[model samples]
Target: MSYYSISAILTSAQKVPCTFDLPIPNRGFLDDNPGGDIAAHTPLPLPLYLAELLAVQQLDNRPLLTLDLPSSLQPRVLNALKADAKSVDLRGQEVYFFEGAARVLELLEEEEVGDGLCEAFKKRAAEIADHARNARGGTSSGEGGEFLRGLDEWERGLFRAAHDSSKAVRMWMGEVKGAK
Candidate 1:
């Protein structure tokens, strides 16, 4: 992702669960307390960027914080995606679901989660392409409407690209026939 990409910024801003490995003074505001110390092992929701930085910082050869999978990539969500990737509302889970997951996976190294996400993206991409190609008059209704509404930002871009390309191809074919 580019440094100036809006999607990268949004993905970095998404919060992830992190547990402090050591007590820290005057950082309790992270856990909703002010002017107090944060105890060791206190779980807090921190931005992905901050959490990743803290988790990578070493204190006595150990990481300062342990990063946990964000709620969006938790087992329940993964199971739902595994069951039916197209039915899961990825937008509801996170606007930048795949990007955020990629970042978290970099820190946590959860191979299963990576596999699940890849599978989900593959399944959904096929569905998105089908919908994009078959959509009538640039409008979606019924099941297609609901599915389109559930697409994350990246998937929406894919759908738009697919839809536009399908239209362009059709126009080109019409032009070719006319010339014949």
Candidate 2:
């Protein structure tokens, strides 16, 4: 649902003039409210589609609202980005795009597919966690850092080869689950 909601909302929408007022119940009001507004509900001039997107974005507890939008939205969003290609700072759009991809990868990983690739991904992730723990969170110029850096490069190549045949699931669990 979030996937479709985000895709639909992200589409280049045309703004139309207000035609109706949506009355929403405004509970937990204070006594010192405006004298002119005494009704228990408020009439907002928001379109229904916008209302639903905002509602889901707020209510959905996923880390980044992880869900792949329809394929159409991918190109639509890409074209939108191209039009506004001055910078990669389409704040909200970037978040949705990235999160949607992550969600897709997560779903693919969950399927009963590509056990070898999964194993390779897990092995690389474990090595990074156990052996290269100190390689992150600081500078990487010391001797120990160089050793860890070598390990990282080897792991990257290993992952690339392991996932070469699997286009659907190219990302490791470490990259998907652990942002750091």
CA lDDT of every candidate: 0.90, 0.35
What's each prediction's TM-score? 0.94, 0.19
Residue 144 displacement in candidate 1 (angstroms)? 1.3
Q: Hey, what RMSD does candidate 1 come out at?
A: 1.4
Q: Per-residue lDDT for 1-180 in model 1, tens only?
A: 799999999899998988998998998888889999999988898998899889889988977899998889889999999999999999999999888898889988799899989999999999999988984823578877888899999999998999999999999999999999
lDDT, candidate 2, 1-180, per-residue tens: 355664435431312112112222332132234333323233332333343343345223432122233342345544543453322222333324332333333434434223332443354355434443332322356543443343322344443443352333434655777786
Candidate 2 — which pairs collide? none
Clashes of 2: 0
Specify the highest-TM-score model's number. Answer: 1
Off by over 4 Å in 1: 135-138
Superposing every Cα of model 2 onto the true structure, what RMSD results? 16.5
